[model samples]
Target: MAVTLRTAILDDIAPVGHLHHRSRRSAYQGMVPDAALDTYGADAAARWWVERWSHERDTHRLTVAEHQGRLIGFTYVGPHEDGEPATGELYAIHVDPGHQGRGVGRALIRDALDTMRERRCRRAVLWVYAANHRARDFYEAGGWRPDGVGRDGWLGPVPTPQLRYALDLTVAAAEPATPAAAQG
Candidate 1:
């Protein structure tokens, strides 16, 4: 299936919310607290997305992937909240469980990185659950590296271990092709 990426709008809240909630539940099933996942549903996620868009729209960017007119994946990127001024961050990226391995995620990441580069960001960073090997592998295959930094974060009421991943966007631009864009 051919996937297209575009900026997300307010009208996309419902579908995006459903996908986000579903993706989180599937991706973090064994890594996050069951209780936290239980309370996270489509409605709650929709509200959360709306709130984030309302408050951070100016500082952040949201991109969605669509296949045959259906929203299947999304990515959020922006200036790094805890890093240097030239550093960008990939705050979140999710592809519906039903749509995994179909290039939706690969497209989203490529689009996110492109946006970061357009914004003149020199580097990028993101955090992932330490136990999420699948996601870690995906990012690593996309040329992201673990920065040897770890932190404690709450997945609902459960404390979880997270690791930081970084990419030098300047170096990426100097290369002929980005791993994400080169993904088959």
Candidate 2:
């Protein structure tokens, strides 16, 4: 089944929040400290997410993925906080635990990059938790490289280490696509 990506609307708040919270809890289970996860329960996280998704257009954009009419994942992007020239930031990317590894994330990322490029963004940037090696590897595999910066964790209570990754869209555009002949 093909996965579809579209701009998130007000009606998507509930399902998007549900997927975000479940995926975060399951994906970050052993990676983040237990204390932090315990303190910020999934319900709280869902509520916070609802609030953000409900009214965050001023500084960010949201995209959702649907497969077989079910919401599977979402990605958010916006202006870079540090104000880097020609850069846009990917604020969040989450796929439902049950729907992961089925190309939903990859689709979301490609759509995000294309959207940012269309917006005149020269590069795409994001931060990944250092301890979440799986996510780090995923980003790296998708052509994101480390920028050697760590900061207070965004989700955990402790100062979670983070590594910045950036992709230059200009260079990406110049890369040759697989020849149509190759598919014959």
Candidate 3:
């Protein structure tokens, strides 16, 4: 089974929201209170995505990954949070729990980096829950490293700490040693 990656369209926003809800619940279990996960249901997620995408479509990129006829994952990329020129930020990448560990995430990140590169970005950065060892390991394995920056962020009503991880897009895209380039 192959996962297909494509630029997300209006029709995909709803599904992206639904998948995001599930992926968040699964990935953030125990990290955040259950109430935090339950605060926003799938419908809310869909609406939120629709609203956000409507405003950001021009400056941001949203991509969906499909397995067969179903959307299994998505990735969102845009300018850096602080508006750093030439720096792109991967705001989110979520894979359905059932579909994870099957290359969906790897594909999404690669596509995200490609999108950033197309945006003329030389650097890529993302924030991850500091306690999420699995996600941290996954990104580290892909050549992303913590840049020693941490921030307190909120998930629903819960406050959490996150670490900023960065990757030199030019190096990863051009270096054969990078996992992303190896896939190419």
In terms of TM-score, the best-performing candidate is 3
Clashing pairs in 2: 153-160
Which ranges of candidate 1 are over 4 A from the true structure? 173-184
lDDT of 2 by residue, 40-127 (tens): 6666766877798667676678998898888888888888889887799888889887776766677777888887887889988888
Candidate 3: worst 10 consecutive residues by lDDT? 175-184
Tell me the whole-model lDDT of each prediction, alpha carbons only.
Answer: 0.80, 0.73, 0.85
Q: What is the C-alpha lDDT profile of model 1 across 40-80, one tens digit per residue?
A: 68898988999888888889999988889989889888889
Q: Using lDDT, rank the candidates from best to worst.
A: 3, 1, 2
Worst 10 residues of 1 by lDDT: 175-184
Sorted by TM-score (best first), the order is 3, 1, 2
Candidate 3, lDDT over the whole model: 0.85
Write the number of the candidate with greater lDDT, choosing between 2 and 3: 3
Highest-lDDT candidate: 3
Question: Model 3, 1-184: lDDT tens per residue?
Answer: 5989999999999899998898888888998899998999999999999999999999999999998889988999999989989999999989888887777788888889998999899999999999887787778888888999999988799998999999998888422222221111
RMSD of 2: 5.8
At residue 117, give the lDDT of candidate 2: 87
In model 1, pairs of residues that clash are none
User: Local error of candidate 2 at 33, Å?
Assistant: 3.0
